[model samples]
Target: MAKSNKPIVWGLFAAGGTVCAFVIPVMILITGVLLPLGLFGPPEASYESMTRIVSNPVVKIVLFGILFLALWHAAHRLRITVHDFGIRNDQLVARAVYGFAGLFSLIALVTLLSF
Candidate 1:
């Protein structure tokens, strides 16, 4: 049997999807709803607290993982959606989508580490 990379791809896809599913909605609720509504105390307090939390190295690594996984998950979905739309040139689509994901993941890593 020919060796295949499907398992590796699928593993990342699954892990990313799981991370996105658990994290994204909570993030949206906090950043989108709670913060603006002042449900998390005052703006200054929230900003200061968030800064403190993100400044920790461990937190930075965790945030980077979440951001990277989320980007990859979205990119994989977009790639599949493009394929479903009958743009059968999968190599191009996969490269474009995954490339964007990789680029954003790198950016996220840098940004997180800057803190």
Candidate 2:
């Protein structure tokens, strides 16, 4: 039996999909729906407040993880989708998608670290 690294990528995909399914909707509800509708008093939606919230190291790490995983998840999906569409060049597609994800992940990490 040949061992493969597919499990690691699949794990990331699952985690990201879970986050997208659960957390992203709530985030949209809070920031997109609730905040705009003034559901809560004075709308804790100020730029300063947001800055403060993300300033915490733990928060930064969490956000970065979510963003990173989501990017990888999307990239993997895209790779599979292109393959399904008969691109016929799995290696090139995989590299392009994963490279894009990696570049963005690095950017996200750097931005989070800066904050």
The local distance difference test score of each candidate is 0.89, 0.86
lDDT of 1 by residue, 1-115 (tens): 9999888887888999999988899999988998899986897989898889999999998889998888888888898899889999999999999999999899888878788
The lowest-lDDT stretch of 10 consecutive residues in candidate 1 is 106-115
Using all chains and alpha carbons, the TM-scores for the candidates as numbered come to 0.85, 0.79
Candidate 1 C-alpha error for residue 24, in Å: 1.6
Indicate the residue-level lDDT of 68 in model 1.
Answer: 85
Tens-digit per-residue lDDT, 9-105, candidate 2: 9999998888888788888898899867776546444666777877899999888888888889999999999978979899999999999999999
Worst 10 residues of 2 by lDDT: 39-48
Candidate 2 Cα lDDT to native: 0.86
| Residue 32, model 1, lDDT | 95
Best by lDDT: 1
